[model samples]
Target: MELNRFYCGDAIKIMQTFSDNAIHLICADPPYNLGKDYGNTIDRKEWSAYETFTRDWLTQAIRVLRNDGTLYVFMGVRFIARLYAILENDFGLLFNGWITWHYTQGMGRIKGYSPRHEDVLYFTKSKDFTFNLDDIRIPQKYYRERNNMDGANPGDVWQFSHVHYSSKEREEHPTQKPEAVLERMIRASSNPGDIVLDPFVGSGTTCKVARDLGRRWIGIDVNPDYIAMSERRMAQTATLFDSFDPRLKRTPLDLPR
Candidate 1:
């Protein structure tokens, strides 16, 4: 079990090689079964086949997770409810939160309201899990003697713009996520030197952020091209994150003397 390495292979098979209770945190953004082109693979699968795939990978993911480990999975609306049930009822993972990632821009739909958000299901292997509130808190909205002043819990609804195609940090991957989103997860759920794993690494935002934050990481992706893309990004010098919570910049009103 090598740390800080990218394995270009099937996620389930790759995870099966890991020892049980080995991973401290996992941030996964698997395909949404929306028929997207992912170079060597297609995101489309029969409903039954997709469910089987989901269960298979999750079984391995849960096995590899430490007792105190946390998992955050990104999903589109179509299958989010099903995913939640599978995590809680079938796998017996403890539900921590249902996070809605609200983005300001997206493709328009004339037939219905445009989709503006994606869901991230947060779960833990057990009741006791790592969550560094101070590391992930947002600034207070108003000054008060009672306020913790350190910051406030970011809550379940997160606002981060998609990594725009024209941005220098953007990769060729179809669903590349903003670095700040992964940063928040890594910062909150795991401490420095803990092992972070991303089974469906995509463009590798999870691995990149984990490395930047001093954590050991493993990234698994089926596509060799994406492995190369991740490697390229990892080789670059670290910079300020591409996006962040707007609340981080807000000034508290009426400072107390």
Candidate 2:
């Protein structure tokens, strides 16, 4: 229940204690039921059980979220559709966008296409939501006098490399997310001093990014090891973040004379 701290417990139970409409942003990366090992827990779950579990935690997330608060959930292809339906129809959360996280490489397949992308669902509790577009804009592809000089919207499809084993930011977790990806989400959805909640904080990417941006954050995970990992990871400060959307580095074209 404490702000800017990591709690080791069930996501739904921990969220139930938070004050209603208190959290300004909720960025959750729950288990994808992929049968992966996560120390004290396994990612696999019975289909019906998984659905119920998702609904329970999401219900609590919606409850603690402010009317203007935004929620971004990272999900795998298998459950993205069902989760979308739950968020849209069951919870009545307004659909903001469906984000595709494109990675350059992934598991290659002999019988089918290689998997290379993940999906994130963005929704808001109400129509009125906080979106600091400038905070998340990427470098424009071309220069035009009519275009906003600050930058351009990164758009729904984003490109961020995976936290591969060779990367320094890579943690022991099987599905660690890129920090820059979470950074963009936090920067766009919440303001300084606002409370950000991540009920299924896997590697603590959300909490760390929020902290660096001056937003208060709460992270919860059932695995004690993961909670510990988050604490250590969030403590370190660096001159630069690990990665960024490639569009941010592209050079804009020269303007007409």
Candidate 3:
């Protein structure tokens, strides 16, 4: 359960190597069916192929997750139904909450309210789940002089700052989630030293937050570019690249960082 892991190849193949009931959390943002080319493939991020890919990894992920653990997934609004169907029937996971995040800019046109939000679904393997509310509370808009309340509990609809296309944090990954967004999720659900697994690591923002918070982490993505970017981000944070053990080798070191 204690490991600093990053796998560079297919998520499904890499996830299989882990044992059952071992992980505390999983936060994944797989391909959004955006139809973008992966350099080698020409098919339109095929849903059938993606579905099978998800099923393969989810099977392993479910087995590796602890009973009271949590699974969080961020999905494009367009693909939520398909993704939810996959999770609901396969895992028997109970729906905990649907978190809505507002992004300042997006791809939609003026015709239909430009899509500016993404959905984050939180589900638990069983009815029993862990929630540390205090870890992610945001402040109230107006200051109250004598209010005994600590901070405003974040509403289901969260308005977080976004990483715009021109920002310095922008990496090679086109669909990278803002780091603040991942920060809140990690804070709300996990503690220092907890294991957080991210199956679609992309530019590794989730892993970066997990490491910054002193959590153990594992991330897997099919792209070598993503894996290398993840390692660099990890390195930039000064998170030691040493695997949890000397003998444990992560999958992306061979690629240039």
Candidate 4:
């Protein structure tokens, strides 16, 4: 279990080698069983099989997480409820918040409402977990005395645009998440020099953000190509994040007269 390295293998198997309570934070974006193509593997599974897969990896994830550690899991609408139950009722992890990643643009559906958001389940191993409020705060919309002028808590609903296909920062991976999302999660949950782990590091967003934020990281992915993709992203430097919360640019109104 070397730090700041990517392992290409089964996530469950790789995590089994990790020492108990070794990871400070885990930001996982596992497959959603939506029949998407991930090059080497298809994101499709039977309902029962997917549930078992989810439980197996999560068991390993929880074992390697420190008592004061935090975990953020990205999942689609289909299985979010089931995931929540497993994390809380089944495993007894401390329920924290259920975040909504609202991407402005997405596939339109004629039969139903267009899908514009995904769910991120946040949990902590214990009540004494790390949470740097100021680290992930967004600017307030109004200049009120009651409000903390420093910044307001970026609430459960997060708004970050998807990396468009033509964007320079976009990777070849099908389900690539924006780096700013990971940036917020890492900043809020873990401190510098802490160990961050991503079991299903699809496009390496978690590892890259962890490295940039000065944390030790371990990324495990089954696809060798994706492992290489993550390596290339780590090597490159960026002046600005690919996406961000729109509220970050807002100016608080109603200044004192």
Candidate 1 regions off by >4 Å?
255-257
lDDT tens string, model 1, 1-257? 79999999999999999999999999999999999899998799997899999999999999999999999999999899999999999999999999999999999999999999999999998999999999999999988989988988999999999999999899999999999999999999999999999999988899999999999999999999999999998998889999989999998798668
Worst 10 residues of 1 by lDDT: 248-257
**In candidate 2, what are the lDDT values of residues 1-257, reduced to their tens digit?**
68989999998888888889899999999899988888888678898899999999998999999999999999999999999999999999999999999998888999989998999999998889999998888778778888886888889888888888998788999888888888989989999999999998988888988999999999999999999999999879853777778887788998778
Candidate 1 Cα deviation (angstroms), residue 59 = 0.5
lDDT of each: 0.95, 0.90, 0.75, 0.94
In the range 175-235, model 4's lDDT, one tens digit per residue, is 9999999999999999999999999998898898898899999999999999999999889
Pairs with backbone N, CA or C atoms under 3 Å apart (clashes), candidate 3:
none
Better of 2 and 4 by lDDT: 4
Candidates sorted by lDDT, best first: 1, 4, 2, 3
Worst 10 contiguous positions by lDDT, candidate 4: 233-242
lDDT of 3 at 46: 66
How displaced is residue 141 in candidate 1, in Å?
1.0
